[model samples]
Target: MPERGATGPRVLLRRLREVMAQPASAQVRLDRIVKIIAADMVAEVCSIYLKRQPQVLELFATEGLNPDAVHKTTMRVGEGLIGDIAANAAALNLADAQASPKFAYKPETGEDPYQSLMGVPILRDGRVLGVLAVQNQTRRHYTDEEVEALETVAMVVAEMVTGDLIDPASLSGEEGRIGPRLVKGLALCDGVAIGTAVLHEPRVEVHSLIAEDPEAERMRLLRAVDELRASLEELFARAELGAMKGEHREILETYLMFAEDKGWLRRMTEAVEQGLTAEAAAERVHNETRARMLRQTDPYLRERLHDLDDLTNRLLRKLVGEETAAVYALPDDAVVIARAMGPAELLDYPRDKLAGVVLEDGSPTAHVTILARALDIPMVGRVGEMADLLRTGDPVIVDGEAGEIHLRPAPDVLEAFRAKTKLRAQRRAAFARARTLPPVTRDGVRIALNMNAGLPFDLPHLAETNADGIGLFRTELQYMIGSEMPRLNAQSAFYREVLDTAGDKPVVFRTLDLGGDKLLPYGRQLHEDNPALGWRAIRMALDRPALLRYQIRALLEAAGGRALWLMFPMVADVTEFDAARALVDHELGRLDRFGKPRPADLKVGAMLEVPSLAMRIRAMAGRADFISVGSNDLLQFYFAADRGNPRLAGRYERLSPAALGLLRHIVTEAEAAGIPVSLCGEMAGRPLEAMALVALGFRALSMPAAAIGPVKLMVRSLTIATAERFILDRLTSPAATIRRELEEFAFHEGVIV
Candidate 1:
């Protein structure tokens, strides 16, 4: 206890208030707080620790023992005396602390003559931010008044650290520029992504520290462990009946095992025994484990890294006391920068809040990348070694499709990026405006434009793009997102919504096309050297009658007397198409007999995506009502190029004479058979390709919502007769530079600049 002449509580508070009022930094305020506390308590040392980041308590200011160590040291959530207080969300006061059972000594901190110690957690909203402590050489017990006074001081310090003492300079600027600029490693996902950088969303950092009381610490750990077990139970319970496959559930079970690992819990207890906070201990272990795993060469072990990272993040939150939302805070329109992102994690993020994604590690074939493409967010990936170079609030630019990034760009660079953004917006706007106009050449040749929809939001494109109707609605995406195999009623609801949205326009719904690269949420795996050639589309459907029958029934129920146009994807030959058509007929006949509702008029079609289908198109033309070319996959197969393989990407050209010849053949056969031919793929989204389709006598072209405007503009500028002649003339020519040739054609035709 201090002597009667020592600084009064009122005086100490006033001085702290004064120090905090100044425009000085955290370091300065912290120093002043430590000095006042030491003087008032007549202690040999006074220290303040602040939560600088997740599970990280940094030593900000101190007096007495090793002043040099102050601001130069950091501990995990549950490190030493200070960490323990913060971790447990409690206070500690002891005379002769060195002799206490819970005492932890640090060699780097050097020796201290202190015989007494008092510590308190700096808390906000019942959450621990850090700790404040004072030590005295005299062997003496701290009084209740002394503890109260110290707690009051801690409150003041917490306020300062938490930005309760805000300076204009402290706040992040409107443009995300503040403090000393920092560069960080960013994870990229998509190859072409461009958007404004924004702050990461906040997630729970730390939870609670190990209690000083052995029994109490044990109870806390056990409770957290139980909660973890419950989490796993719920996950498993949901998975049992959910849409996800057994393998996904297996991954979840593995995560549960990692959480319950005996070694992990033992380390937590050890930290508590050492008087380190629980959060600190867990974080230390997690970081060490991460470091070790990073060095491992095994692929299986490396994948386990994600499991560990997730479990550690969860355990650390429980220990240090933080929520998952604290990990990032994003604006409505912002780009995400991260080391990497799992597909599940990406689902939690708001689509509107996400403008683009920049990743440090990701490939174009990654699931998250596919999702990014689906969302139409520009993304750039594989910019390794960015996390260390960039800070949380630093400016970043990502070009998703192009795979480019600019950090702390110069004025000219910023202007150029902004200009590029404006041009893209302008182009999109132009496309939307053209949607109202018919997809016809300036000479007045009519062409049918449609949209390829997967989600409900995609329905609006039918109206916005002035598309004739949905040429292809991928029915499997709904199943991919759900937890269970969606009931027939649920599928009916969505199908009805799409049809109603289209009104009188034709809406072609594709059956559940799962297999190959497209993974099913439910556990069903058959490893093959080439999945693309293996079971998929009609092949998988033919085997899984239950899956195919369900979709057919849903379509029939949803049609509700309306005209329903349906198609089967990846039909290899006329026989597959015939078999698929027979199945649909069987379903229709069964529904009629059972008095189940179905469309009064249904048009059945098949996608000419496979090369075999194209070869047998003449036979298929008479058997099928309509034929739509799935050009994206068709071109890949035609050239023997794996479209998703980055190494082989850009190796094959869609405009190559061979691919074009096949397309011409399909169109001619379809025309001769008097069947309407359309294209639903990425190629149709391009302006020049839209023109090519027009020349090839494809009256219908279906694309994504965003591409409608651009393609419309190209259609409006084209002269169908001239385009056909120009393309045919080049078809026989020996062209080494096809892209250049196409560009020259576009320039000559005045379809694009």
Candidate 2:
């Protein structure tokens, strides 16, 4: 064995590589890799344990830790340090392995010389493949350099074992080493892409249990109970303040009651009294609760698992003993995999490094999906809980566009993906070149193209894609991203940057449209039978003039002589429109008084989301400078179907008769009043929907950046006159027949509907 420090890291790495380069089978290569590691680190023992099928780790090769135990030894994840490392895909650098409580001594191995150990799990694309370790007799701590060196060697070892490089057939398990790569799963989002499987960001939240000093534990439980009650009180207060709907407040209050359940608290107190640490006690109680609740066959009861997980993680953070299981030094081009994530938490990651998102748990309405679409990251959700199957860095293939995930994908799969990726790049090049070619209709009617934006991060995309300007800038995102209410100055800074990005081009900014399914930091949600119809958007803003004024002032200050378009959401009545406009005027007056710079022409608009707004379109058009239809919310509220509820989801269709009638009404009224109107929502993004809107007398559309290309494709393919005629015919016909007519039109026009 080489003396430690006698050889530099490079020389050591070279030696290790030289050893692995020997002509040998996978097992031989693994053995030599371990041997080189032991020699370079001057360790008395070396071992490598690869993860077996399912969940067990089988001992593969070893130098000093019991050669006889090879293939005979096995450990379940969390059984020992090896087990823990395997389960968590984390490195273990213990100075005194023998003294550690987690160390599982094996008498049958007949090896006890090692007192210290350093193990680095072999990870490929965020999944654990195996562990590489070197143990020394002396109780010594491994340096950071040693850990890094070991990790690098492990990575090379993984490449060798997987045969991803060298022998392609070895990895592909077939001759020629290439074939069609196709894997399918449930679709979370509707799209197709060929991107590498990036694991979702790791989310490890732990809830703390109260201390077990009988009395102290009791007090701790009491404190948690009190905190739960206080949260409910705050929720109720917000509801009363008109910031939250009554139903949302009720849900929160119910959650608080569940948190204080006598039986649940009793279990937690028992764990604490049993002398477990706060975190452990909490975990135990959490496990018990999950087990108890999971047995229930009721869907509603089963859904409480999500709530429990959220509550437990929060409590674990309070305990302060919780450690994130995996520590990923993410690569710039890597994909992220996780069970699930909130919108704010997803932003913690470096956006550029992110390629796509793979989740074991996620729904269409999940906030993460909303952010993902805005970021243009290909994402798949509800991946059936694959987090446990993954390590910190396991090689994976995720095709967000195809709604597929491949674990340890074969070599042929990789090759086919690479080829498809090249083709996608070529297509993107075509799309980029086409962007400058103009979005004129076949008969020469030009269409405006704009991008939907939410955050400052989305600003750069304006230049990247063929977008005319910012269309719908969701203002609520600012409040949603922060822990508390963002100050007016902070809001102004963001708004100013956005307007400056747009330059002379118009940027439409939406006011705070938070409530119902969305959350507010300070306001209490009011109790109502149905939240969607309750306090939200313009309703909340009208009741909270301070919030409305603050946002208006920020927008005005940011415009600074630029052409600015501001819009409010859920305007149901002419009175509501008047009130909202009044608030905007009031804020402008204040901004003038404060000497804040203002736009030379700031146009205030109202989003025609509420059905009532659709009914009073003429009145609204008469009062407003411009109007933009928020179709996503409009359709939801129009049909009385909860947007997020999948059960009632299919009941309301965007292309349905009822929705089309309402849209036509708004368009006819807006045209008669000569108020320029545009649809700026998901409906505008759908090619057929865009066509229908244009045909139905709507002249402008605003959609997501990606949808711009497809919609423009439609625009270039059909004459505006033809589209207008078809739309009029469809609208004039009975509601029951519009869907078929639209489909036929889409087919005849080759619009790829």
Using TM-score as the measure, the top candidate is 1
Instruction: Compute each candidate's TM-score over C-alphas.
Output: 0.61, 0.56
Which residue runs does candidate 2 get wrong by more than 4 Å?
A: 1-274, 277-337, 341-356, 362-377, 382-427, 594-597, 732-744
Q: Indicate the residue-level lDDT of 443 in model 1.
A: 89
Structural RMSD, model 1:
15.1
- Per residue, candidate 1 scores C-alpha lDDT tens digits across 267-304 of 66655444334554555455445545554443335445
Candidate 2 per-residue lDDT, tens place, 1-753, comes to 234776745566566556666787778777777777787788888888776643667788898887889888888767788887776666799988888899887765655877888997765433566778888878888887678667656655655655422332222223331323333454554444434444443344332212325466557656765665564455346533235332233344445555666786676665555444445456555644554554443333444454565556545544453423223456765667765554433554666776667776665434456556655677776665465455545566667655787766678877887787886677567677778778887887877888998866567778877688887998886776444788988888888888878777788998988877666535554566776778888888888888888888888887776777898888888898898888888877877798876678878888888777777777665579999988888888778887656588576777776677788888888888878888888778887888887777676788877778778777788777877766666555555436677888778877655
RMSD (Å) per prediction: 15.1, 18.4
Q: State each candidate's clash count.
A: 81, 44
How far residue 415's Cα lies from its native spot in candidate 2, in Å, is 14
Stretches off by above 4 angstroms in model 1 are 1-318, 321-334, 340-356, 360-395, 401-403, 407-415
